[model samples]
Target: MSEATHSFEESFDWVVVGSGAGSFASALVMRAAGHSVLILEKTAFAGGTTAKSGGVMWIPANPFMLAEGEDDTLEKAETYLDALQELDGGAAPGTSRIKRRAYLENGPRAVDFLVAQGVALRRGPDFWPDYYDELPGGCKTSRTVVAEPFDTRQLGEMRKRLRKGFAEFNVLLGDAARMGHMRTNPDAKKMLLRVALRTVRDKLLGRSFTTAGAALQGRMFKAALEKGVEIRFDSAVTELVRGRDETGAERVTGVRVEGARGSGTVGARLGVLVNAGGFGKDQAMRDRYMPGTRAEWSLVPEGDTGDLHREMERIGAQLAQMDQMVGFQTTIAPGTENDYVLPGAQSLTGKPHAILVDQSGQRYMNEGGSYELYCETMLRRNESVPAIPSWAIFDRQFVEKYKVADKFIDKKIPKGWLEAGYLHKADTIEGLAASIGVEPAALGASVARWNGFVHAGHDADFARGERRYDGCHFVGDPYADDPARGTIEKGPFYAVPVVPGDVSTYGGAVTDEWARVLRPDGSVIAGLYATGTSTASVMGNVYAGAGSSIGPSLTFGFIAARHGAGLGNLA
Candidate 1:
């Protein structure tokens, strides 16, 4: 073993960078193993995107499956995942295979471990159907698990340092309205009513209750705290330090962290795990990596500026999928510096009556496609337009039947959006198009065709009526067979200019199945690890379901910790 006599002022068995699921899971595992672990979180809060996310962990064949008598076999999983590999064209095949194997083989094991560690896992309320439902190895199952509601009070002093996404709590209803999928689904209506009642009841009972994304993150946050993981808030990792032994074997020695207390070095006796997120908000990196995107549309936290990627790259870590990122079809608030509007809750599942179009005023893709696809299309559209902002055109009737995001809609459409010209309102389709700088005649023809489809109950242009996803439910009774269908025939149409927005960048430093960073020569860099959005995503570009991002994050984090701790006789 490396001599403990090195007079290390501060050292941990493992130093986990980032506060997302990957970081927390690794720290929890190492701490549980009786190893001292210290987590350096750049932000004040420990959850990172996990806290700001819809805390579902997508694990196929989890314990919930067994309880519900669902059939999920390793063979079936392998078959499904193999199909994904075929789709990916074998990019980073080794990493992709290992990830699929880990997820399929150890998925149940990870869930069991979390449960043993006091994380209460429950079947989520709904199953977001597989994106490729028709593909082999894909089927509807209770594979999604969420942590029970977490009580932030349990964190004690730590709660003050935690950060939550400003837009997370607000409900999303505009997306559903745009798709016209469901305004009167009894189940959806009941769920909304239940949420309202619960809010009132919790207030009456002097208890706390949060539904949706907030509830999910809260549960995981509480569970991580209970496991005795040390989370340092407001501490940013400025640099990754490396050193070589007499044999010239590369190893991570420590990390330089900066905080209000002043900057200092924290040595890692075992390994350094980097889960510090992606460069979603870094203008320089975005301009370099994604030349096509407009930097203002990034919806990620301001702190996610590729610190981990830059630091790791300085030490010669290889990167993968640099051309990819988490993509979204989004609307931007007029005259605001950073206000990007995402598809409201209802729109995510395809309830709204909106379709995304390119610069020439032509529809580009399935409005119900994955957010990643939406982003990719936006980037592609930037090839032709000076700016790649699309229009999310809707009618007043659509607004009446469903809600938009709590942030966007009001008793009257926000005047700032209208006056500043980010949003355009018109009594007719032609007028609306003219206000938004589109060809009035062309837009009029498009609206007329869309209305004809709505009345005939079928979409001939792009088959918009074919969408069926769980997130599509909305409020009111639009009375349409295809729940996401509504006509623009109603006068007073509205249009909100949209751009490509993203949760985070999907591509970054590449790692193996063990979460060890790899050099350009295809060799592992001992003592170096990465997880979360800082690493190339295991899911590739397709979003299979909710919690897809965090599931692999937590899993690989555990793998990295275990691998690092088991590096016997490092000296």
Candidate 2:
């Protein structure tokens, strides 16, 4: 029953639900256009998955790419997209073709718009390549953009109002600033030692690390407030309230939200935006939409419970083509918080000296492949056996050369981790297998075969390190004798369990090119819109480039807000 419009929160021209990049960007655009916009976050603090992420927005042929003199164009991007649809089996099931077109056409515009609105984004590193760079239409330069650090001091009383980022690694990294400098400066060793000493000192003093995603969210929050956008936390929108016009046409007018204060209806005149994140933490929905996916392994915030899709579905929303499959996997320590599991440890997995094997001690894929391909292989293997808890077997040599997740560096494993069973160490490969409960002979033989492949620089069985996009999207020494292939001959082997993990669910409420939620019959639901993971990702099944997730989020959120505000539909 509708609350007779008598008791309500202060009405706004537009009510935005959720505070992810898409939702926050929508609120910013709406308010910038002079609309009365309200931002509601279910969690006590703002910044959803985006704030906990790399804060990179993938925009193909974006303004950033254009400014960099990269030869990217709308037609070329479409050609690339065509290949993606082929990967998804066809055009995404319920979504219109125009939706994909809209994303391609306006992705640059959205980035430019957000930059103009005070988002502190900079082009991602030049060394970074598309996740699937070898695929047709992939550009070789920076397309994903990262945010410059935002000063939390500016938030003042609102300083602690942001959600913690990836165990605060994305935020807290006093020494991480040195990596950027080391890349460009000649005295790299000196700079690295300087940051290392400071990092050690800060850790000893228990100083908090603050940077990256949190900074971006802080800046975005600051921008929203500067533009007069009002945000209320701990307010969960329970239902989308609709009203009828004289012609009997149904349209969403407001939302029914419950909070610490009390339950109340909040009216919106321009439109109601449901940009809450996907069903990462919603187990019931996960089983229904993404069977075999684990909630405990997801990187999304706890508040990403698919609430927006649930409410919108009750009002006749349809499901778009959400393959909603296993996203990606990374090695995680046993006792670490789920949020703290090595952000984009793609480098860790793809580096030489390691091999991923199933529980039975069998190698199933190229260890040096992209994160998307690695998890895709893991999921495909899970179809036969339990690949969810497969092991990444590596030797002491690997640890000495590279950091594994956040656990070990420079050949040293933290004593606490060993005590907590995070690291399974053994003097011999067979012994390591026994500790992890796998076949001893099988593990030993697999390591022997991997050594043969490494010596040959060609994986006879799985072809590890053979791809152009290997080594975390071509970041480190693409020309190394074996970028991701190394002999696992050294003793004192270790095993870190791998799982089928994801940043967010790919599927959610169905929407059109203009970001309007669609009915089962494919009609646009007037006055209702969806963006980000709350809707089916426009890219279909494949991970395009980096930032593929947020690129669509920003673009469609902008498209939806613009269309809802009576700006003529440009799509």
Tell me, by lDDT, which candidate is best. 2
Q: What would the TM-score be for candidate 2 when compared with the true structure?
A: 0.89
TM per candidate comes to: 0.87, 0.89
Model 1 lDDT tens row, 12-64:
88998887777777777787788988888787666676665556677877788
Global lDDT of model 2: 0.74
Cα-based lDDT for every prediction:
0.66, 0.74
lDDT digits (tens) for residues 121-237 of candidate 2: 777766556656666886656577767756565676777888766534333232343343342334556856765676576667654444566766777888888888889999999
